[model samples]
Target: MYPIIRMVKQMILHRNDPPLSAMGTHVSHHRCWPWDIDLWMELNNGRTLTLLDLGRIPLAHRIGLISVMRQKRWSMTMAGVSVRYRRRIRTFEKFEMRSRAVYWDDRFIYLEQTMWKQDGECANHALYRSAITDRDGIVPPAQVIEAMGADNTRLQAPEWVQGWIDAEAKRPWPPMQD
Candidate 1:
């Protein structure tokens, strides 16, 4: 089941936070629960992605993206992601998550997120490509920016992020066909 209750808790916890600029980072704390673990007694990879949402969604809210989406009847979707895990999080262990928008092109917004252990070591990091959409189809980032009244500052993705984007462009789609 989706952790809807945890998500609502996160939403309520950050409800009074001051608004942030579109590119500003949001920091949040979370703990791994027994249910979040896999058989290896560490945080499950899939649950890690779900927990990242505790930061990402509030990030969208702080940047006013959620409000704009609600008013414009638009929706957001994750188009792709790349994650690297380096450390294990045991049940009941606390960690901090940081999330921010790295850049955006005409088509998509790129977000970077990281999880840090209590000792300050990075547990994992992820880069996500997100798209805003309407009933017609995917909405352009430019239009989304205009709708949010955000400064249309052009941002260049970092070299590593660009490399990932380039690599993804070359990857074959719909694999394993008979």
Candidate 2:
């Protein structure tokens, strides 16, 4: 089940929080609920990714990108992601999620996020490739940045993110195609 209501709650909670730069971090708190766990009594792997949405969307809101998207009738979607899980989150345990935009290329935006336990341990971390879209099709990263009014401040994409882009470029569209 999608946690729409929980997402709404998170939106309202962080609505008044301070804004941040494109590369700055936005943090949100969440608990490992029973529904978020698996048969082994740990947070489900898939649930971890879904809950990260709660953090990323608010980060967008704080950076004012959400408003820009709404004004332009644009939308955003996750194209791909790579994540690392280093620890287990038990049901009822509390964790803080942190998200931020890391870089962007001509077509995709890259974001990095992490879930941290109260003791400052990272439970998981992920790098995401996302695309902005409109009714016509995916919006180019340059256009999205222009809409955000950050067009003049160009930043180089990080090396690791560039590496991921390079690897994806060499992958065939229909991987099964001979």
Candidate 3:
């Protein structure tokens, strides 16, 4: 089941936060609940992705993207993601999540997120490719930014991010045919 209640809690917690720039980072704290663990008693890999929402949505809200989407009747969706898991998170353990928009291109917005242990070690890191869509199809990042009243100028992505983007382009879609 999706953690809807926790998402609401995060929304309410940061409801009064000041708006941030397009590339600004949003930080949120969370705990690995018993229900969030796997049979081996550590945070489930899938649950980690779900928990990322608790930070990402608030991030969109703080950056005014949610309001823009609402006003334009648009929706945001994840197109792809790459995650690296390092440290283990035990049940009842607390950690901080950081999410930020690294940059955007003609088609998608690239985001980087990290989960940090209490000891300050990075437990996991992820890069996300997201798209905004309307009734017709995917909306360009430039258009989305303009609608959000943010500067539409293009920002160069970091070398590593650009490398990932380049690599993804070579991946065959609708993969694994017999």
Q: Against the true structure, whose lDDT is highest?
A: 3
C-alpha root-mean-square deviation, each candidate? 0.9, 1.5, 0.7
**lDDT (Cα atoms) of all candidates against the true structure:** 0.94, 0.90, 0.96
Give lDDT tens digits, candidate 2, residues 106-147. 778899999999898999999999999999989988788777
- How do these models rank on TM-score, best leading? 3, 1, 2
Per-residue lDDT for 78-149 in model 1, tens only?
999999999999999999999999988878999999999999999999999999999998999988988889
TM-score of each: 0.97, 0.94, 0.98
In candidate 1, where is summed lDDT lowest over 10 consecutive residues? 169-178
Candidate 2, backbone clash total: 0
TM-score pick, better of 1 and 3 = 3
Clashing pairs in 3: none
Q: How large an RMSD does model 3 have?
A: 0.7
Clashes of 1: 0
| Model 2 root-mean-square deviation | 1.5
**Candidate 1 accuracy as lDDT:** 0.94
